[model samples]
Target chain A: MDGGGSAATIDHLFRRQHGRMVAVLTRIFGMHNLKLAEDVVQDAFCRASEIWKVDGLPENPPAWLMAAAKNRALDAIRRERTARNFAPELDRLLRSEWTVAPTVNEHFGANAIRDDLLRMMFSCCAPAISEESQVALILNILCGFGVDEVAGAFVSGHAAVEKRIARAKKILAASGMLFEVNSASEFATRLPAVQRALYLLFNEGYHGACAETAMRTELCREAIRLIREVLAHPNGAAPASFALAALMCLNAARIPSRKDHSGNLQPLSDQDRSQWDRDLIAEGLRLLEHSASGTELSQYHVEAAIAAAHANAPSTEATDWRQVVSLYDMLMQIQPSPVVALNRAIAVGQSEGPERGLMALDAIGGSERLARYPFYAAARADFELRLGHRDAARAHFGDALAAARNPDEKRYLAQRLAACGDVSAPLQR
Target chain B: MAEFAYLYRGGQRPSSPEQSQQIMQKWVAWMKELGEKGHMVDRGQPLEQSGKLVKAGNRSVTDGPFAEAKDVVGGFTLIRAKDIAEAAELAKGCPILERGGDVEVRPIMQMNM
Candidate 1:
């Protein structure tokens, strides 16, 4: 491990350390100086890179970075703070330089870091902040995601992410909110937003917003890790959270088989069943069972059940399509949206028939956003192709190809378009 | 043509991962431009704040190379140019300057063997 020290080690340490470091530093410096906390953590990494280039990675690299951050944090406080009782939390050890390291250690210790990360997540997902900003803050501050990544997640530009994060920090600073652990009641209000952000994070990774070269399993992993952290806490665990976790697990299980060799989005039908992670599916099923005890079903519960169905099915054709369609029906009742309708229509085609699916999609029409949704048109083309309506399939495929944003998607649509081409030019034959 | 070193200095390092990545992209693009023009003699790197400084003819080794944070040279790049003016012109597109920083373009004097 020591001899084979690579950038991968630092990359791993960076993801692990950044959020925890920011959290502990935020606990000390307050959210008002969260930027300083982040800068100090970043500086520690820069220093580590320089030193490690010559000295090799230290025996305990994470500990080494933590020590550097601790020193930098103390230096920041001493230089910036007025000669007053700035940190009342450290009144016990503030008098002595010897205690400074101990005090910092106490906050940055594993258990304390875990607690701080939870608190930081809650603070970022504070209901007061707008939902988008909450997500941007979590990705930027906690998850170590770059602006490009977040913006890419958004399917938007970097400028918007910069502004969103800036606005989020402003809200956090001015909201006069304590970064301490939230009360059971307070956490109850915040949990929904936190769960929403986490789910979105997972989905963004699963169905990328850009032409991502890599799968970004890290994002999905981080989302699951945070969800688990929340579920581990007494205040945070609820039926909904467990359901969300179950959904994430079920989806993540299939992530390995989501893409083909050419980097095209592999339909569930075309995916290699052998590549699916059985252990993950088992865990997800276990979590889904636990969620069943709750009186009221959340959207997570509905979604997770659908995912579980797919996970358990031996093949896509053998799946309980009717059950999936029913789940989507429930979902529509709970949260009716054009996207849901589009998904439901495809599922309906599997359960019912292609013509019925086309009818459902036709009903879902009107929104410009849905009109531009590649999946909606692709699904329509798929249903049309199934029903032997070659011209309609070709027309729908044309729309799908035009709407395709990424190369894989474009390639997939091109193939489908070519399939329709033989029938589309029947007059030539 | 003369060789020159562009010493990049004083830009406040980004406080967040997102910001740092954007800054990194700009630098890569800037370096790519220099590389494409065949002006890049050496693709230099950003420096950390910590380094030992040996003074008094290498007799006294001090703790650091920096007197102040802002005065620290963040990175340097070697390039070929006609003269100091052309080197300075090449430095004009430096990414650090977009942030609060300046590029010190100095000609590499040709020493006789």
Candidate 2:
């Protein structure tokens, strides 16, 4: 047992290593043997927990686990052969004994395992799966999320989420999809899908679906980490990935200020700028600059720029609503979503006038997708409040509160309702 | 230090045969890269979804490879290492990690023959 190694040091080792081991093994064996491979891997981890409990931790815990898994896999293969019913193809694989020699730099080399993991990420988030499933799968496999955690991300129940994952895996196996990162051209084509996955992940964190504690922070941080990893890789890094990283960082900078001392939600207007993380803000700005190096602006780039403007502001009043509106305009042109248009209308209300913002919001008949979205109601409430329509504002605020999932968000809406002279607050109940 | 097997799991949703071909090609390329780097030792055969597990004194025979939808084991690779750390480091480069699958690392117990 290595004295230097501690459980805290390898906190998520079992979870994170789970994905990496699966990927490397799958690469060696074909996808058909996935079930056996996973069992071997899990057995290895279980053994580690048992051994480490008595013998103390290994110096390189991850490597120790990997080695155990390999031995078990070899044993399983041999056992299968003795049954004489072993597949001829597997028999061939068992016959070839390849050994990995250890070099000082070989372990934890930057390109060694990280590259495989990234490739795996790209493959899992392939455009083949629907965006919803992609996020769900990534959260479960890559992030080690349980079914309940994933279910919380959607409005659906646990069973529905389970079925979705089961259905996804069935499709993947039936389709015989091999796990590999797309080529440069293919990556370019699939960039949107990857970006969407990251975006959805960030949103899950931002919207506070997973949990109330630092889980949101973890999700946001991981989303940025993944996007950064993509951008850092020569072949994997696309401008959009960088933009997404920048956007996430910018949003993340305000995370500390998002919640008050009592853990109540603080709207942008009330959040203390001093609480924002300047270092993260700087990183966000730098990445945003790198993302804008190209002539064409992606929606992610525009969104990041908008977020950057907010981060740079010392107060809500200092936010460059004009620039934000302009970027939103560009974003609408590139990827016109009702959500984007709705957000753009908010910027217009701030930069141009409430009347123009109202007109813009009214032009787009509320899409069904926006029906359950709390932000739509919140934005409507804000617009109506500014236009002196107190009654309308109160009603919209109530709608926003009903749609709100997070306790903090519900509190924020309740406060807003109170301000609108609605003495009766349902939240108090 | 130890031997490790990185396991890949989970199945792809249905797709066109052409897409399946493309995925296979990628898998081959990835394996080739690992082989070239000398990180690959014994590669396990890709097993079909069906298999029987015999366990306990009764040697109970159950439906083979029966697991929850997402918990299936797909494939594995056996790599020798100085220790578990080295094996884990090698497992990091596996492509299956991206597909919501996991890599399990373990040490091989030397059998006295």
Candidate 3:
């Protein structure tokens, strides 16, 4: 038959299908056979591409693909005499006729497949690796992100990002970690690391420095979807997960407002509050409230609370800096990072005085991580500007402008430099 | 039953003779397993990465297998199955996955032009 049938689907059908099939197969084959499971899924997509050019698209494309993938997996198993060496248990499991069915639901129940995907996420984001590596691996395997997309997220080279992912996968494989959704207590222990990974993924998407616009949106949406999945499951849902979701929602509500009509980045102060997604804002607020109901407050709970306050404000002038500062203080107690302190310093500058903010910033000392961060320079410039130190503000703004990767950010820094009014002579390096 | 061919893509990078022999040993072990299960249609063998792709229009022939190592079609396997689904079910157990390689499972077209 002509393979024209499957060619009509959306572009990412293969990639998305690849993830689902891998999750389902991994559930059946066990995590140690992840490579085999992923290969089977990839092969199914390759077959679809070839046959769909002639046979036309299937009536139920996903089901057709799943059935094809399952069959390929089974055939490969039957052919391998040494499968006993690698996966004896999986070989036994495959011998049973129930796993490889013609129908998708018959092979992998719908709910079971979804649970497997969630389990894959938890396993990929285990606390064994650095948070940076965890997010990169999740984006690669779960989201089907390319090396370049992940590299853009980290503001680093593609090779560096690829190495990070390869290393993370090796670590996971070596640890003999299995893909299984954890119980409430187990999830609770790992929840913080998972939350951090999700937040980093969201930030990467929201920043929009990546190559494909849709990819960034997908990352944001997927993070939200996974967080919601966690919240829906009885054992998976936790206050921390809810708070992380709320924070993402609050931040995402501003996505449409962040960029202007010309697609330029609009600073929070310059954004039109009316452009924000009110439904999302309301949802974020409700989640924040639920998160706060618990006695133990997490960094996410405080961050979401702070984001909620910003969303509720009608204008930058209307923002309750005192409340934001207090939340920042609470966050600092929970997670002591120079980045958090820098953010709190900005809040302090607005609430109290630039002098107080400067003192807080200075007390933190030099942080190597933030040394290259443009936001740190921007914050210093803002504090300097508020203190009427025009020369110092101009120099710091120049530093920020040089370091800013996004064009809109560079423009904003230039504008800030102009506002400093040190135009008499060009500022020296 | 329909015969399916699995294209195994590996050895994109030049390897030592020793490494190539090791790979072949693994392939032989794999083939033995498939043969015993009665899944083997014929004795499948690997082919060198030197071939031409003829385009439909003008029937233009491209240079010998010019593509990225990852994109190159490496080798193939012929297996017997009840249907396309059955063929795909068999392709899953291939060892290519361990080496970060891919398999292309396709039903052998019955009719010739």
Best by lDDT: 1
Q: Across all candidates, what is each one's fraction of true contacts kept?
A: 0.10, 0.00, 0.00
- Candidate 2 chain A has its poorest 10 consecutive residues by lDDT at A99-108
The CA-based lDDT of model 2 is what?
Answer: 0.68
Q: If you score just chain A, what TM-score does every candidate get?
A: 0.92, 0.86, 0.86
Off by over 4 Å in 2: A1-5, A81-93, A97-112, A175-182, A208-213, A422-429, B1-113
> Per-residue lDDT tens digits of candidate 3, residues A139-165?
777765557756765668978988998
lDDT of each: 0.78, 0.68, 0.71
Candidate 3: CAPRI quality band: incorrect
Answer with 1 or 2, whichever has the higher TM-score: 1
> What is the DockQ score, from 0 to 1, of model 3?
0.03
- Name the candidate, 2 or 3, with the larger TM-score value: 3
DockQ of each: 0.10, 0.02, 0.03
lDDT of 2 at A138: 72
What digit string (tens of lDDT, one per residue) describes model 3 on residues B1-113? 77888876653331212222233334545565667678887655445457887889899999777777776776666888888887777667665656678888888889967
Task: By lDDT, rank the candidates, best first.
Answer: 1, 3, 2
Instruction: Flag regions of model 1 displaced more than 4 Å.
Output: A1-3, A6-11, A83-101, A213-215, A365-367, A423-429, B1-113
- Ranking of candidates on DockQ, top first: 1, 3, 2
lDDT per residue as tens, model 1, A199-309 = 878877777656664535877888898899999888777999999999999999998887887677788888998999999999999999988875969999999999999
Could you tell me the TM-score of candidate 1? 0.79
